[model samples]
Each structure stands twice: as C-alpha cells, then as structure tokens.
Target: MQTTRLPHDGPEISVLALGAASLGSVYSEVSQANADATVQTALGLGVSLIDVAPYYGLTKAETALGLALQGVERSRYTLATKVGRYGDKAWDFSRDATLRSLGESLGRLKCGHVDVLQCHDIEHGDLKQLVDEALPALRELKAQGVIRYVGITGYDLAVLEKIAVEQQVDTVMAYCSFTMQDQRLGPVAQRLKSHDIAVFNASPLGMGLLTRKGPPDWHPGHETVHKAAAEAARICAEAGSDISRLAVQWALQKAAEQGIASTVIGSSSAVNMSDNVAALNVPIDAELLARVEAVLAPVRDLGWDVLPGNGGKAGS
Candidate 1:
C-alpha cells in the first residue's frame, strides 16, 4: 500500500483509506462480526486512515470500530470521526454539543482522543454558527490535544472552497466529485493546496453510481444519470473489464496526479475489501478508460439535486 503525508503538516496516511459507513450499515445491515472482520482486513492491507461519523448507523460504526480495535495499539492507525448532524435531519453544532459529541466519540471508540475531528456535514448546518461557534470549538480541542487535525466535510464544492479560504481548517473532504464521471475536484485542488490544507476525496465509485450494480435505492441520481452509468458499465464489460475496478483505479490515479493525499472507500465484505486494496496495483488501460468515460459523457457533470440548504445532493 502507498502512503502520503497530508499537505499543511497533517499526519501521513495511506493513499487508500478505509471508510467505516458500511460497518454502520448505511445501505444494508452488517453484523458485528462482519464489521470487525472488515476493519481487521483493512488494517491487514496496510490501510492507516479510518473515517467514520456519528451520523453513520447512529453510532453503531464508532462502537463497532472501538470493539474491533479493542486490544490494538492506537499508534497503528489514524482515527477520524465527525461531529455535527446526529441523524438524517438532526443538526447541532453548539459548543456544548460538540464537546459532548467528542466525549461520546472518544468513549465509543474506546480512545482518549481522535487524530482527526471534523465538523460533519457542514452544508446542512447554519453556516454562520458553523464558522462562528463550531470551528472555534474544534480548534480548542486541537489546542487541548484532543485532536491533531481539524477539517470539514461537505458535498458542495463552492461551499468547501469558501471554507478552505475563509476558515482555519487543516484538511477538507469532498465526495462524489473525483470519480470517473466527474473530475470537478481537480479544479479545487490547487486552491486547497494554496491554503496548505490537505485534500481527501471520498466515494470514488460515486456512491455506487459508477459500479455495475448501479446506485442503491437511496442514491439521489436521476434516471438519466443511472442509465448513463449502466451504459458505462456495459462499455467496460464489453472490453472484458469490471466497471467498479476501473472506477477505483481511475480515481486513485487521478488523485495521485492532482496531489490528493488519500481516497476513502467503504465495504463490509472481505472480498470487496481485498479487491479495493488490489485495485491499486492494477495498471490503467487508457483505451478502456477512455471508452468508459465516453460512454458516461452524457451524464458527465450531471449531478443530483441539491436540497436548497441541506448541502447539494451527491455529485453536487
């Protein structure tokens, strides 16, 4: 596995990081044993950065991770979890709430403190309060040695750019923007680098929109987008390749070209975990990738609807 040091003095983490939402069972129920196995598999593969949130499975992810890492030394991996929204619609960034959330996350992860503490889903919260109250609180926690890095996660590229320039964050996570269908994240890489803030792109598969199985029911992509994705898959299949495998490789290569520190991916099954880890070693076939990209051109940059104030939908 390859590793990179986050720009702006952030910790060194694996280029292919583990996302823990599956352990939280966002799309399907994952047993505790499966969740434990998943984490162990990731660690065994040399994945050092693990991202989770209190919102995922409403704390199940953190608890499962805590149990999985029970006897493991903390120094072996870098832990990251977010605080802000507690549920699908619940939004809270109050100082007291942030403090309490951190304490609870610490307890749930069975750790003294986290390596990275981000303001979760900032686009869904009051921007004023987030900039005014929440971020300062995170900085305080960093000062107290509770967290080593501070950052924010959101789906809106514009909003993330705003935060990167105007606020004091060490890193930023942009999802669904760095996939094979959309390369929007490349435009903002230099901007973030200018601020010395590390960049982490999540959902390289476009939240499953770039895979052969297609997006899940909860995915926000429209019918046209789904159709385009299916076509993209067919293009790959015709070339005797798997679209999901190509998608992961493309995203990883793009991240390296753009100087992204890591890409976060989630999976519950060990087979999927092994495949994702293995994808890094697969050479990119330019002709096949170009064909796949051509197939998805119709939906290129065609993102889902943004919920007015609740952060732009996927690919936004």
Candidate 2:
C-alpha cells in the first residue's frame, strides 16, 4: 500500500481509501459480518482513510463501522463523514442542520470526533446557504476540536473548484470526474493543489460505467457512453485482464500523479476489497491500457451531470 500526505501538514494517508456506502447497503443488503470484515480488512491492508456518510444506509453504515472500529487505535486511520444531505430528496445546508447531522454521525460512529468533516452532495444543496451557514459551522467545529479538518464533496468538478478556491477549505472530494474515462478533474485538481487544498476522488469506476457488468439502469450515462465502456471492458478481457482491476489501478496511480491525495473505492465484500488492493500490485499492462483508452476515446472526459437526458445530478 502506498501513501500520500495531505496539504497544510495534514496526516499522511493511503492513496487508496475504503468507502462505506456498500456497508450501508445502498445497492444491496450486506450481512453485518461482511461489513465488519470489509472495514477490518481494509485497515489490515494499511488503508488509512475510511469514508462514510450519515445518509448511507440511513445511518446503519456508521453504526456498523463504529462496532468494527471498537478498540482499534484512533491514530490508525483518518475517519471522514458528511453533513447536509441526509436522504435521497432531503438536503439541509443550514447551520442548524449541519450541527445536528454531525452530532448524530458522531453518536453512530462512536467516535469523539472525526478527522475530516465534509458537506455532502453540495450540488443538491443551496449553495448560498452552504457558504453562508454550513461551511462556517464546519470551520467553527474544527476550531472547537469537534473535527480536525473541514471539506466538501460533490459531483461537479467546476463547482468543486469554485467552492474550494472561494471558501478556502482543507479538501474537496468529487466522484466520477477523475477516472481514466473522465479526466476533467486533472486541471482542477492541479489548481486546487496550488492553493494547498488536498483533493479526493471517489467512484473511479464512474459509479459503474467502467465496470464489466456495465452501468445499472439508473446510471445516467447515455447509451453511447455505455457502449464505449463495454468495448473497453472487452479489450481488457481479451488481454487477460479485468476492467475493474485496471480501473482501480489506473484511478489510484493516476490520482497520485495528478495531485489527488487519495481515491475512495466502495465494496461490501471483504474478499472484493482485498482483491482491489491486490490488483494494485499487478502491473498494469500498458498496451492493454492504451487499447482501452482508444476504445474510450469517443467519451473521453465525459461526465453524466453534463450529459444530455440526464437529470444533471443522477447516477453520481
């Protein structure tokens, strides 16, 4: 496992991180034992960033993670959770809601304070409110020792950059915008680095578009995007490799090179999580990657939010 240091003297964390959305059963139900193993296995593998959310599994994920982390040294990892959005349609970036959300998350996580506190899914929240109320609340918490650092997470790269630079936060996390197929975050991340703000990229698989099984029906990518990914998957398979493996390795390695401090991957199965870590060790086939890149050429730098027919916020 490789590591990268956060900007502004933040703690060094693993380049690859563990996402707990699956443990919360967002896609499907996961047994408690499996969830525990997934978190523990990631830790044993030297994963230092564990990201969860109050909206995930409606709080089940945090509770499960709390139990798994019991007795585990607090210094072993950086814990991150989100505020603002608490459900699919519920969003509150107000000062009161943000404060209440953090309190609930801490109770569920069984931790005195989280290392990083982020404003979740800002694309859906009222931006003026986030800036006027939510961020101030988070920074206040940071000042009071309730959290060490403050950040924001969203799906829009441009907005992320705008807020990161304007608000001057510790970090910014954007998903599905930094994968091999969509490198839109590269330039934005570079600029953010100049501000000494650490960067995090989630869903390097484009939230499933880069997977072999293909994007789910709810995925917002156009049909053309799906076809391109399918061809890339086939090309990798013919080269005796899996697209998921290449996708993970490409995201982690590429992110590290692009000034991203960490990339978060979500999975419920412990075996699957370990396999992802192992995939990083297997050298990425250059020719195979090039071929896959060619296959994905048509949709290079694409994002569902900006794609036609998408709700602009769905499938992220």
Give the best candidate by TM-score.
2
- RMSD per candidate (Å) reads 2.4, 1.6
Estimated TM-score for each candidate: 0.94, 0.95
Clashing pairs in 1: none
Worst 10 residues of 2 by lDDT: 307-316
lDDT of 1 at 155: 78
Candidate 2 per-residue C-alpha lDDT over 106-144 given as tens digits, one digit per residue, 9 for 90 to 100: 898888989999999887789999999999999999889
**Across residues 1-316, which tens digit of lDDT does each residue of candidate 1 receive?**
9999865466679999988887887768999899888888989999999999888889988998899889878888999899887987787888888889998999999998798888887887888888888899999988988788888998778998898679958889988888988778887976787778888899888888887788777787677777888998988888888898998999888898887879998777778888898988989888998888887887777666421212323221
lDDT at position 298, candidate 1: 75
